[model samples]
Target: MTDTPTSRATLDQVGASVTGFFQDLGCELLEYSPDRAVVALTLAPRHLNNAGNLHGGVTATLMDVAMGLCGTWTEQPEQRRVAITLSMNVNFSAPAAADSRVRAVARCRSGGHKTFMASCDLLDESDRLIAFGEGVFQRGALRSELP
Candidate 1:
């Protein structure tokens, strides 16, 4: 069977529960699906380091959020899947200035019933590569069944 496209409303709710840290970090879910996930954030004074550029930790967090959610993509809000990062790696290729709009796109590369691997690319509005990450995640309970 062909893959069905997930709705925008369903996609927006993708990380509502498990993304507290990312949401608190000012990241917003732009798009989410089994094939790809997009997340974005705007840099603020608090997001910078002593040198006044984007902090590396923030970059990594964005990548992690994107990668983690991509594998858990589900069209059903009640049946949403959840996964935890088993291993992750991030590489920074450039620095983002204050107020830059950063976006991350992640896609699942391979997977099984128990685990999946994904990759993410963090970029600025101009599409400059800021950083990228890859991770292996273990599947967990569904959101509705998480109690």
Candidate 2:
């Protein structure tokens, strides 16, 4: 389904329940579906490298977060699962300056009972492809199974 402002609000609410490094990265969920996810962030001084461009790690983080969500989403939001990154391959094609509005759109390429593969394209406000990536993720437990 297409993302509307209402859905975006719902996405934000769900995102708020998540806390940690993602919040540190200042990423926001713009849209999501069982097979796809779109996230946005504005480049900040903290996200830039000493050379004055967005850090590769920041781009990778965006890809990781976007692609992970692409694999984790379920038709029933309450039934959604989580995943850990097994591997990720990213290609940086361009640089985005600090303060630029960026977006990462991820699409699930394959999903299995235990694993999934996804790809994401990162774009700048100008719509230039800044980075793109593919990732492999393994499903994680809903709750601790350890004693």
Candidate 3:
């Protein structure tokens, strides 16, 4: 990442890019800001697990995306962040049915020169908490290069 006036522009560009990327995945942004972000996705049959409930991987992915994006919203253009999922502890509280509108809310807890930490929760349409996660990510290089 290169910090410059142009970097600020790139940051804005990333916001749009992130939105587009999720939209393509059938997720919609309901709220977004530097400290928090919320996204929703309608559970489909394709997202089901072997037992018929929403898959654990799907829930984890949604939480991760939301948390990472929350960090992105606060980052300077020249300073990119990569979500490493260094540690994610997820608690599944309920089973989510197909066609349910699932919402993921992510909040950044702390961030600094080289790392960021965040938490996220996944809720069903009725606002029932289905799962929650806390994650740590290393920031600076692009995600592809982060280890």
Candidate 4:
């Protein structure tokens, strides 16, 4: 990530280099700030189900990841935080075809020092809604604080 002029710009600098489960799912971080996050996934064969559409589990995972990231983002890298999903509800509206790209946009709706609520929308390439989710998350130990 390059040295950006603003926190939001800095967040946007991180592109498809997300690690762990995000990397495994081929997720690209498009934009992230205090209360919002946008992540795109490159759909593949493994992402589909028996009916040849995006699996509900995959959609739920994407939603959880987006909401968790949205709720836990911080300006200070060293202060990087984590959010554990307390509860989540996913509403599947449309089907996403294999090999098609989908983007999940998430927003933190409300929060305290220890917990937060967030919502996410999964959209196809044409911006059709694939799924919508809402979740409550609890703040967890920071990455730096992890043993």
Candidate 5:
């Protein structure tokens, strides 16, 4: 299904309910499906670095969140998947200006018993690619059996 503003809002609420981290970071989940997820963030002055552009850490955080959500789409209540970043490589293609809306689209590339690979692109409102990233996540055992 195509993502709508209402659906994105709902996902943001759900993300907030699941973890305060998103709300605190001013991040929102804009789209979600089995294969991908898109996260949005309104660039704020606080998100900028001394260089006067969006910080690399903020972009990395958005990428990681989007990738994790993509992996979580396949999770079942009876089973669970926990992911830890094994490696992440990011390339800043352009500076994300302040007060602009940024979207991070993450796609799952591959997976196995305990590892998943994903790639994400950070785009501005005009769909200009600002940064790109790829990461590997190490999945933990099912939650039911975990202490």
Candidate 6:
């Protein structure tokens, strides 16, 4: 894949381009800062599992995206970069039914030159915790950056 750096003026545009699937899943970038990020998605029929509730994978994805951005948002807006997930652990605490507006809030708990650790909590519209996740990410350039 080609890597194109994003400018601050186009953060939202770039965010959408990088994770189009999140958009397809009805996820939006609710808030972002150097240390934290919040993302939300409204549960729909397409987001449900056979049990008729939110799918575990969907929650995991939301957490992953939130935490990953927690690290990415640390970079200068003029510099385009991506966070590679080195490891991630997710726990589904409760089932979220369809039509629920779930939000994933994540923060970069710790970090160093090459790697960073982030944690996330998935909450329903009512602000109840539904899932939790943490991930180790490696800071890197997009493949397109390679000569």
Candidate whose TM-score is highest: 1
Determine which window of 10 residues in candidate 1 has minimal summed lDDT.
Answer: 1-10
Per-residue lDDT over 28-123 for candidate 6, one digit per residue giving the tens place of the 0 to 100 score: 877667777788888889999999999988888899888988887634444546788999999888899988999999999999978999999999
lDDT score for candidate 5 against the true structure? 0.78
lDDT score at residue 10, model 2, on the 0-100 scale: 58
Q: Which lDDT value does model 3 have at 105?
A: 95
Estimate candidate 1's RMSD in Å.
2.1
Lowest-sum lDDT 10-residue window in model 2: 138-147
lDDT of 4: 0.81
**Model 5 clashing-pair count:** 0
Q: What is model 5's C-alpha RMSD?
A: 4.0
Question: Per-model C-alpha lDDT, please?
Answer: 0.83, 0.83, 0.73, 0.81, 0.78, 0.80
lDDT of 2: 0.83
lDDT of 4 by residue, 2-21 (tens): 33433544554443323567
lDDT (10s digit) by residue, model 3, range 1-147: 223223434434444455433545577666656767787889888888989898888888788878887776534433445455577778899999888999999998998866789999999988899999898876545542211
lDDT of 5 at 137: 87
User: For model 4, where is the 10-residue window of minimal lDDT?
Assistant: 1-10
Better of 3 and 4 by TM-score: 4
**All candidates in order of lDDT, best leading:** 1, 2, 4, 6, 5, 3
| Tens digit of per-residue lDDT, candidate 1, span 24-127 | 89788887766588989999988899999999988888898888888887656778778888999999999999999999999999998889999999999999
**Candidate that beats the other on TM-score, 2 or 6, i.e. the better one:** 2
Angstrom error of the Cα, residue 65, model 6: value is 0.7
On residues 1-147, what C-alpha lDDT tens digit does candidate 2 reach at each position?
Answer: 545333755587556644577788888988787778888999999999998899999999888988988877654454446778999999999989988999999999998988999999999988899999899999875532211
Local error of candidate 5 at residue 37 (angstroms): 0.7
Q: For residue 130, what is the lDDT in candidate 3?
A: 98
